[model samples]
Target: VALADLGRLPVTFATVDPVALIRNAVWANSRRAKAQSVSVEPGQLPSTTVLVKWDGARIEQLFTALIESSLRYTPAGGRIAL
Candidate 1:
């Protein structure tokens, strides 16, 4: 099933903002952050807009994985800056 879904994965194209994408990913994982006593901070996101065409869903998933992996080693009351 998972293998089949790989071929069907929705690939989308849109102008994506890196900062907003990071912020959205952090917001989406807020619950986990609270539970783990981990704080996610959005650092100096470039004031100059960054535009890239890509699959937003896949990017979100990537951020989720990255955050989750960080949570593994991050102690309580830790912070993650993007």
Candidate 2:
């Protein structure tokens, strides 16, 4: 659902920290992950602020979708480190 409007819209990219984006995405889904007995956490990320030219919102959306998808197949008590 998140990428449904991709091509039709102009993607606005800016300097952003992808690790922070992933962290926020994981935080947003923490409740759902807990309800499903799944653990979602951030994986090894740069200690320093790593900025890349990309669409932060889209990156977050992509991570959210990926985590949600993993939640579907990941067994209960399983861990997912993004």
| Best candidate (score: lDDT) | 2
Quantify all predictions' global Cα lDDT against the true fold.
Answer: 0.82, 0.90
Error of 2 at 47 (Å): 1.2
TM-score of each: 0.79, 0.87
TM accuracy, model 2: 0.87
- Per-residue CA lDDT of model 1 for 49-75, tens digit only, reads 768897777788888888888888889
lDDT for model 2, on a 0 to 1 scale? 0.90
lDDT of 2 at 40: 96
lDDT of 2 by residue, 1-41 (tens): 44555656557899998878989999999999999999999
Least well predicted 10-residue stretch by lDDT in candidate 2? 1-10
CA displacement after TM-score superposition, residue 20 of candidate 1 (Å)? 1.2
Residue 35, model 2: lDDT of 96
What is the clash count for each candidate, in the order shown? 0, 0
